[model samples]
Target: MSFKGEQHPGVQAPTPDSQGFRLNHTMLRIKDPEKALAFYTRVFGMQVMRRLDFDEMGFSLYFLAKLDENEQVPEEQGERTVWTFRQRGLLELTHNWGTETQADFAYHDGNAEPQGFGHICFSVPDLEAAEAWFDANEVEFVKRSDQGKMKDVVFVKDVDGYWIEVVQADRLSALGD
Candidate 1:
């Protein structure tokens, strides 16, 4: 059966030649690195897999990932860079230097006006527990799971006002259909 639209005869999906093609990371610019790092690490339990500082460019890049409990990150910079690039589903936070000192500094969260980039999402094992944790931590909620028509999903705002969709991993199949 044709899905979405009719497919032309003798046409097939194009496949990449290489084997290890994976999404490296999604980057988000933040006003404060410390606040962004704290939220991703303390709230979501993601680790700082690697950090790259550009003193000349006046910026820093922090790559965070939800690694396995026992997975050890390489200590050396070169090894860690390779290891980080190998991992999938990474979040890269870019922090420009000296923005933290400005009281009115803010990044365009991509939710207002133009609204180009939507939001990043996380699938949790326990939706209720995650929601409870978010509430306990005083995270700003754009839409709670129970509040919206899609009752199984929740959207929360980060320190930089970026929307993060949180959903139950087990219910993903049902949600997809």
Candidate 2:
């Protein structure tokens, strides 16, 4: 539904046209799919659900869980694409046309002074275990739960320098601390 906090006076009671609206995916412009895909799938357990390439456009990739290799998937490409869009909690990473060749290409990770887009978050089943795993894997951290102003949250950075907030939804009480 709506984001946390009560809807403001002007935005209360969503309009009829927004009835079926859903956030299909939040996209990030990545410089290299190889590095980005490895981090997401290896670290977060996401799989490459679908790969869409526009003839005129550079990139359109959707990552999520797909049927196991032994399982049968839709034979038609169109059907596969539809399956990806219909699923919930999608994270799409797109690479520009020629960024692959540029060794120094990078995105303006939105955490800078003129911040607009903040970060995307993931909820783990166990907060303590997740933090340990991240530590073992050397995932860069913006702040750790123990040292931060907040008690039970972790902020990490992706290959593209985007901040990823990790949390345990069950421990809602620790957030305010």
Best by lDDT: 1
TM per candidate: 0.89, 0.85
Per-residue lDDT of model 2, residues 1-177, tens digit only: 456456666766667887787877788988888888989998888887788777577666655552346855565888978877876678888877679789887889998979889999998889889888888888999988777577788899988899999989987764452
Q: Candidate 2: list runs displaced more than 4 Å.
A: 1-5, 65-75, 174-177
For residue 156, model 2's alpha carbon misses the true position, in angstroms, by: 0.5
- Judged by TM-score, which candidate is best? 1
- C-alpha RMSD in Å of predicted model 2 compared with the true structure: 3.5
Q: Which regions of candidate 1 are displaced past 4 Å? A: 1-12, 17-19
RMSD of each: 3.7, 3.5
Question: What is the alpha-carbon lDDT for the whole of candidate 1?
Answer: 0.91
Can you write out model 1's per-residue Cα lDDT over 1-177, one digit (the tens) per residue? Answer: 456454789866646675568889999999989999999999999989889999999999999999887888889999999999988899999999999999998988899989889999999999999999999999999999889678889999999999999999777666643
Computed on alpha carbons, the lDDT of every model, listed in order, comes to 0.91, 0.81
